[model samples]
Target: MRFRMILLIGTSLMLASFTMPGPTTSPTLDRDLEPVVVAGQQMPSFAGVPLDQLFVYAYSGGTWHQIPWQFDEVQDSTIVSSEDGLLDADDQLVFMVADTGDQASQEAWIADENSRQYPRYEVVVTDPLDPSKRGWVYVYHSATLASSVTQDYVNFDEVQALVTSDRYLLGLMTDHPSMDRLELNGSGVDILDRTKIRAEIQFLGTYTEEDLEASRPAATRDGRVRVVIGSGDLIAYRSMFQNILWIDLTSVPMRVLWGRFSTDLSPTASGSYYYDANTSSGVVVDGVSDSVATSPASDWAQVSGTTGTMVRVVDSTEAGGTPSTYYKDDGAVDPTDTGDQRSYGDAGVRLDDPNRQFTFRTWTYVLPPDQPNVGATYRSYARNPLQAQTNEQYHPDFATAPPTATSTPTETPTAPPSMTPTVTPSATPSATPTPTSAPTDTPTLTATPTHTPTATTTHTPTPTATPTTTASMTPTSTPTDTPTPTVRWRVYLPMLRARGSARNAQNGLVLSACLVLGSTPPRIVAEVGA
Candidate 1:
């Protein structure tokens, strides 16, 4: 592929000419981002709206671009920024959801100007006169944050423990989780020579399974440990527009398995192992059964060096983990498939929590191995995690949020005088972006090498359009309750069996500046963590 994109831009300019730190014993941090808001009472037209000009947007294909919004301001619990500027309430209008599936595997979250793919979106708004469907994500309130979008597709380098994304480069086993090698972004071939977690606690009196010969839980009992996410920061949450990679191993300490109590008068029934290491090959992560999953849970492992392929997603199993009999591809095994089925199993992220501690919220994906339907771009944003709601008014704006998309209207997007409309009072993020007729040198990252991924990939909503008198004013009032961001349950839940986390009776979201002026204005690139 063009010499694998010129050896990944010459190994990313030799990884931006080095800077080191992360080996382990902690502190490599940077990417555990988590904080996506829009409050100011959801926008009473954003009342005064000026916390450094505020901006955030995601409504793919058709229009309404502009992504990368940060304005922190937590106060009391730390994160300050009230400088009187406006955008108050608990202040935080942060933003992230760029799990970079690039608009669900190339539907074009724009591909020029700077690069675009505003991923984490879900809007179905269909009342086009009542067929009755609901769920929307179109909040455009801005002072100016456009040029189109791109920045934070996760090139994160925490000292090269690396967290790259355009699809894979990852290598950090620092602070553990079965990753110490997994290259596959440009055929650089590393295809995982590591990754393990085959726990087994047993107990409850003579817990026999023919005496632990790889004791179930997808067997491989303690098959060389791993399934670790970081805390205090090993990357707990990242955002490329919901670019999911959150593994809150509840702040460290995970036991692998340690059996011994045949009955030594039961010293409080102990059996500790908590991650020790055993396996050497690679791709261990076992656990399978739950009637063989559809999407509520799943676990299965198989990999034998093609030098690539790592999707790795496992979630919220405070205990009893297992699902998926097999997925097959890299090495497809089932010699007589003995990884048991289930016997109180667990592959990773299983907690009995008596200090046996375990917590692993999931979402790990890396595409770019020629990019041709890598299992539908990680199952439409890594097993569908959609459920974001807030209302005050979007005034018949763009619509469509199904399977991953919607209808079209085109037009409304103008503001390219450097995004015209700055309230002055800057708080950072103003480098380059006053370009206009774009095309500095063919960028838009070619979007992970031009789209093909399809297992559904919908989302074409561009509704209103053509407007522009500042997008014909539209902003209803009434919606109090402090910035509203309570649409929870994100251990990556396939949209909770098709929508069931609830949050759409209007909680908050107001920025009716309505302006999509000019074209390709979704790239302002300023992730100030604000």
Candidate 2:
């Protein structure tokens, strides 16, 4: 008995030890990674470790430098600047927001990049936006931290300043019932109403977990604000109007596409950006001014201060899918790769994480003087230059790639705007049965193409790529002015098939039982029904 008990205890201990999480192993980090500087270069980098965050490095004098503000917890934090050139050597205020229990712990500091030290934090009067709540926003000279409950806010959450040459734009969110937008003047806080803003957009739904992690909302270097809002799983973008000429980041979609915006441009509010998951590089807009749409249309094009370079967010994985693999430059989707059947309109390239043994180069495209895709496609590639540059000043081993050949996309015919799928009602006796079985009669999908300004084309083509096909074509659907009443039932067959043939058989059996019992003689029906 004693031996058995000891044996059982030993087994339990062994099992516990085996089930416990193993000690964290050192990750294969890509330490040799450098920045992609210049406008026309496309280089690629690879990594084994997941990209935590990306930071951009600038060369000042003979040394490569990143601002000290990018660090977190004695470790390297800022991969790239959220908004650069905001704080000068003297004209900026800095502070930290620390969460302490329910009340926030905020400390004001004077930031100086020259010195490794900062002023001792002075705790100012704490006013809860809600007296019943605990979180608070810490205001500084030219910056602000809206929520100061914990260090996680600083460590993980994207913090950026929405500043122009004169004023700072702030986004305030609180648990209270009333406060949404509150503006603070030198003396007191005034509630600012955005009711007159004609272009305001509300949340699509709650943000998905993946959306929250991959999402980033950026403002232009000039502080034209953009905020990515993820409500539910659906992702959309909104941007603020740039002096009524272009859209600001505040008016852009607050989803994954927003994160694809390159950190290179200021007033990055309205430009279209791409994210290539395959290469893992940020999309760098070339040759186009901040005001031009990747297209020629006003819907996609906006005017801005910077031309010849810009960055907007895009995703090749979700947007380009199979075509993303052909992108060759700096891990970005090669705009000229013939193998790519995906439309470049919404697709952007992605960059790999940086680690040792990894070398990266950056290339930009030299767009033709005229919108090459104009009239033939939805967007024209006229004014946007495609050449890229790299910051290999830190590492000298980077390789430069030659430009690839470009191909024009095949265009699809336009469908009538009202030819969309709609449910029809029918009072016919066979309507229910027909809808339950007909699956092929469903209406087709057609996207209203978004036109870019630089695109020479008169109309923008909507991408038609699906999981099964690589080409972007317009969805082919049955053409009819009006769908029959039974169309609604037929459209629902795909969903009904999930119940399986057994359930369908059971339903048939019940129907048969009811029909026969009702139609047969009483004595015969009673005998069969029993």
Candidate 3:
């Protein structure tokens, strides 16, 4: 947004009619005396009478003499002089006016004796050519008060003074209560300092609504200044005003940085780490990296040197799944690598210690390559042991008892051989019928029929066996567990690829690796880029 420019021109001249030398022996009568003219430029006014009215005064001999003046509409200037020799060449003239007609009603102002308690007024004059350039003139018709009236509004000049031409300015307007709360909370200062952003705070003391609004037009211009109102409900005001950035100090006590990690690990391992660009610190499992390493490794195999603070903390190594070891620097130090050094520590005893055993270890050095290893390979090995044992026992019994003999069955008298069988059955029936044989034959036939019916009923259960075969098919669901590893790899491989891509995008500046020794505190192994 652009600001309008205004130029002010003040013209004071001695009229030719009043060129006669002063110190006239007799005070010139009203008829012979000529009026002195005072002409100046001012913005058009819509104020009510008496207040909008302009009056001129001349100062001489430590006393002020009021002079009648007429405003010219076409010239936009005020003309003043006196006919009773009151306007002298040695006198100084000043123009006075009220900001509004309401000030004219004050009793202290109307009673000339109490003029010392009258209000003060500031008259603003703008350049006719560039109206934006304006100037203020203070006018006092009575004795000056000990304290001047506080201005409720801010002008364009005030804003221009607060901001630098090249930098962005954030202006905060708040009341005493809100400012006190902010200070007690001790908030927002750090964020501004870290970002190197400029901000100014303005305290509003008993300013009216109109006073606040009058200052907003000059404050809200975009690119010139960003205004934030800290007291009232910012949401309500933000919607009401356009191009003004409103911030609620009570709600947002601090500035938070929000960003997305360019690289993320899948199933996130325990020792995995990331660096915060703003803090220049690496985040590890134990906490932020105490030591910072800075050097470029020409290749992945090259161990770049690092320098910073270091602390000994316990780290669990994936190698043995044990915490019975500590990390010291490996003997692979390079003379050129300045700050790179080793850290050493002892692993504390475990409950299952057999010999009060303790182990000491050194830190391993590894650095990221100048380029990502896209076709890298990894290998792992596993082993299992088996053993078997057996026992045998036997028992024997010997016993040969007496010999057994088989006897031949004798032929029944039912028939001599074949014919005797048929004749015996007929005779046996006939014989029994004579007494109870006939009843026995009928019961035997009835028993045979009942056995046949029971056999037919047993066949119904044969179809039930088919459902048992279908039940075995449900066990197929167990195969779902087999795909778990596949699913894991599917999810894991993409993350690795993404991480590699991110590293490559950075020109292989970041290095991610696990800490050596199964029992050292987590540390971020970072290699700075050249």
Model 3 scores a TM of 0.12
Alpha-carbon RMSD to native, per candidate: 26.7, 27.5, 51.8
Report the C-alpha displacement of residue 493, candidate 1, in angstroms.
22
Candidate 1 or 2, higher lDDT?
1
Alpha carbon lDDT at 488, candidate 3: 6
User: lDDT of all the models against the reference?
Assistant: 0.27, 0.19, 0.17
Which regions of candidate 2 are displaced past 4 Å? Answer: 1-43, 47-49, 52-55, 68-191, 197-227, 231-388, 391-530
Better of 2 and 3 by lDDT: 2
TM-score of each: 0.22, 0.19, 0.12
lDDT of 3 by residue, 379-442 (tens): 0000000000000100111122212211111100000000000000010111100000011110
For residues 1-530, what per-residue lDDT tens digits would candidate 2 score against the true structure?
Answer: 99999999999988756443333212121211111011000111111111122222222222322221121110011112232323221111111111111111111111323111211111121111222321111112211212122211111122532221111123322211011221222212222221111111122221111111112223211111111121101111111111100111211122212212111111121232433322222343332322222321111221111122112222222222111122211323435322221122222222222111111111122111222222111112211111111111111111332122111121111111110111111111121111101112222222232211011001111222211212233212211111111111111111111211111221232111111112211111100110
Evaluate model 1: give its lDDT. Answer: 0.27
Could you say which candidate leads in lDDT?
1
Candidate 1, 474-497: lDDT as tens digits: 211111111111112111101111
RMSD of 2: 27.5
Count of clashing residue pairs in every prediction: 47, 113, 16
